[model samples]
Target: MEVNPNEITNYATKFINILIDYSPKLISAILILFFGLYAIRLVNRVIRKIMLKRNLDPTLTKFLADFLLWALRVLLFVTFISKLGIETSSFVAILGAMGLAVGLSLQGSLSNFAGGMLIILFKPFKLGDTIEAQGVTGTVSEIQIFVTKILTANNQTVFVPNGALSNGNIMNYSMQGQRRADFSFAVSYDTDLKKAKEILLKILNDNPKVLKNPAPAVFVQSLTDSAVIFAVRPWANNTDFGEVSSETLENCKIAFDKEGIRIQPYLQELSKKNS
Candidate 1:
């Protein structure tokens, strides 16, 4: 059969005309997508500026801005796609499924992040504060989004996840203006309690670091088979805790020796040696 050239030309012309007619719509869609992305970027910049002015934490600000910016961009893209005559129901469903999967996979991490935010907002403990949390006692070095960094008294760095910290009890020693230095001294049952109490009180008077307002407390806390346990509790500034504790122990020993107070020895050790 002979080909109809004129008919083929007519069909080609119609197709070209159809494409020309749809060109404006195509251009409009492209413009919408570009403007949507630009608007997202602009919004992110505005958020960042506001956060900076408010003196918000840099990490949190960045996280919020990025999260919001991406969310806005995705919304805009979806709108653009729908405007371009694509069905968005399947897209939305796919996004939902992906989000659920991600949430499940990162549940622990997300909880930690939330816990960190709570910790930062509440100001429970700040950097450089000595705290005991999650069974670790150390100076807080940094509070990150997922983990809190601590400098241990032994000079080791510890990274504790925020979720565990937030869930557990926190003992902030630095928060207290003054801390009590508690010591238990054992004396022979025959030793005079009045003389020992007087010696302890005199030692407290000599130590200028000990706070005089609360006054030092001395009492016989317990009577064991081998000795009488005397409790000595004194208040000192948090900064002077270590120094005051060591000094109190050393001075107590010296004071007891000078006052002729005898320390009770371990009776079990004597029995073992004899056996």
Candidate 2:
């Protein structure tokens, strides 16, 4: 069948009229989108500047700025779509459902992320500080969004989930300005208690690393069947806790040996017989 020229012209005219009727709406939507995006960008920039001026962390500042920008853009796009006569309630419902699904799937990770955020905001511990959390003790090397990295005393890197750490007891040793070093030693019953105490006190007093303000405590804590137990407690800087503790023990041994104070061993047989 041959197409009529008049009929083709009529079809073209109808299509052009439809386009003309929708053109203004489409242009208005495009312009709104452009202006909305620009406004979002400007708002994000202002937020970033304020955060910087307030001395916020760079990572947190960037995250907040980006999140705000994306949220604004999405809202703008939704508005633009609604202007073009598209229903957005169903779209919002779909988005909500998807978000709920994702949240359920990532529940553990999201909990950890929230815990990490709390840790950062509350600052229970910071990088390079020695902390004990979730039965693991180490120096915090980094604090991320989901996990905290720790460098153990033995030079091992350990990753602890932030959720467990935040919920558990956290012992931040570095937070204490000073630490106590408790050293105990057992001496033979035959040894003079006064003499042993004097020797230990001299040893501690000679150690320059020990704090002088708190002084040193040396006393007979207990008397067992085989020996008399003496307790020596000294205060030292937190940084030198391990070093001072080890050195104090070593020095006590040397001092006792020089003073002829023999460390009494726990003899089960002798104890049973005495009992």
Candidate 3:
């Protein structure tokens, strides 16, 4: 069959007319898309400054900023698609379904993430803080969206789930900037109380790690069934707390031995019975 020239001409004219009808809308949508992306970046910058001013935790700040930017971009894309004469309600529904699926699949992780957000927002414990929680004592090294990394006392690294940490009691030892070094020493009942007190005080004063402002003290804490107990209380910087406590006890013992101050046997009666 011979093709009609008029039919081909009519088809070409119709296609051109369709293009002409859509050109302005397409161009405007494209312009808005580019402008929307630029505006998103600018908004992100402003958000960054605001987060800095608020001193929001860095991990949460970055997560929130990225989430906001991506969410805005998604909405912008849907707007652009709608402007191009495409239906977007289906797109919204699809996104919502996907989010729900993810939320359900990652229920535990989502809980942890929410807990982490609470930790960051409420400021219970921060990075580099020495905190004890969930039966582990460690310094918080990293705070993430789902977990917190801790460097334990024995130099071991622990990854604790934020869900547990946030929900549990956290003892933030470093927050107060100082800690008390508490120790007790027992001497034979026959030992001189004044000499024992002098020896304990000397140990605390000798160590520069022990703070003097709090005025270290050695007092007659109690009289045990077998011996006299003296309590040593000293203040020290939190960072030096362990060292100060250990050194004070060790040195006090040595000093007591040298001074002939008897550290009564813990089981003095048992020793006597055995003898």
Top model by TM-score, which number?
3
- The TM-scores of all predictions, comma-separated, are 0.72, 0.78, 0.84
lDDT of every model, 2 decimals: 0.84, 0.83, 0.85
Model 3: residue 36 alpha-carbon error in angstroms: 1.3
Clashing pairs in 1: none
Tens-place lDDT digits, model 2, residues 1-275: 99999999999999999989988888899999999988888899999999999998665676678778888988998999988778999989999999999999999999998888888788898888888888788999988888999999899999999999888888887876777766567788899889888888888888888899789789987887877888788778888778778888888888878888898763111100111
Best first by lDDT, ranked? 3, 1, 2
Stretch of 10 with least lDDT, candidate 3: 266-275
Q: Per-residue lDDT for 1-275 in model 3, tens only?
A: 99999999999999999999999999999999999999999999999889989987787789899889999998899999998988888988998999999999999999898998889889898889998898888899999889999999789999999998899988888898987766667788889899788878887898899898888878987898988978788888988988887787779878988988888765111100111
> Among these predicted structures, which one has the highest lDDT?
3
- Angstrom error of the Cα, residue 73, model 2: value is 4.6
What is the number of backbone collisions in each predicted candidate, taken in the order shown? Answer: 0, 0, 0
Predict model 3's lDDT versus the native: 0.85
Per-residue error for 55 in candidate 1, Å, reads 6.4
* lDDT of model 3 at position 75: 85
Residue pairs with clashing backbones, model 3? none
- Estimate the overall C-alpha local distance difference test score of candidate 1: 0.84
Give the lowest summed-lDDT range of ten residues in model 1. 266-275
